[model samples]
Target: MEEQAKQKLKNYVLWLLSRQEYSRRDLTFKLQKKEASPEYIESLLDWCESLNYIDETRYCEGFIRRHLAKNHGYARIKSEAGAKGIDKTLLAFQIEEMEIDWFQLARTAYIKKFSNITDTPDYKQKAKIVRYLMYRGFNYEQIEFAYTHNQS
Candidate 1:
């Protein structure tokens, strides 16, 4: 490839990364979609990794930060990272280190979707709150905590 073409590919990769953090595999696939060859792709990835331009660990941490702040759970974040080709070990470590307030998060989601859960005594109403929290990727512990506290 010509100098300009290589530079173009490099610039494109930088541009993509500047917008958002991407998994190593995700970024590779994205660059491939732009017609960058395998050899060039690998070389570029090597450069990026060495330069600290794309760190999967940092990406995972950032992803965790964003998702957790958005009130997501371990299972959901883990699955999403796996789908992007992140290693299970790394994902697990991220989850372990995570300081998620499950009850507060669950309560937030429950309230956002269904207000005044404690006021409703009907089984169906309580079930709706449970279902809503579950759908938002909250675990049993968090759901129970939120529901019980809300009832009080």
Candidate 2:
């Protein structure tokens, strides 16, 4: 490849990466959209990886941290990462590494979504909260303790 062509691809990759952390798959797709040649694209990607300009493992860890901070559940994160072409094994490992109180995450989301829920002692109200939590990717067993414990 000509030096000029290689530089342009590298520049595009650098610009795309400078915006935010991206999965390798995301970067590849974006570069392809730019019509970069297959050879330059592959070589450029390899160069970035070698230079540690795009570390997918670090990107995964950061993505997990940010997504969890947004109160997203394991299911949503798992599925989202899968869509990004992240391997199931890596997703599982990252989910395991979260090491967070998922109940608290669920509780916070529940409270935020239904602040008026606990004001009344209605079964229907409780059921709605339960359903909401489930929709947010929480397990019934995990949220059970929060529901019972919150009453006191």
Per-residue CA lDDT of candidate 2, range 1-152, in tens?
67887688788889888988877788888888878778777777888898898887888888888878778778778777777887788777877876878878876776677665555537877787778777767888756655655543
TM-score per candidate: 0.88, 0.86
Clashing pairs in 1: none
Q: Name the runs in model 1 displaced over 4 angstroms.
A: 118-121
Which residue runs does candidate 2 get wrong by more than 4 Å? 119-121
Worst 10 residues of 2 by lDDT: 143-152
Backbone clashes counted, model 1:
0
Angstrom error of the Cα, residue 139, model 1: value is: 2.1
lDDT of 1 by residue, 30-133 (tens): 88888888999999989999989899899888988887777776667777777778888987887778756777878776666666444644788778776777
Evaluated at residue 64, the lDDT of candidate 1 is 82
lDDT of 1: 0.79
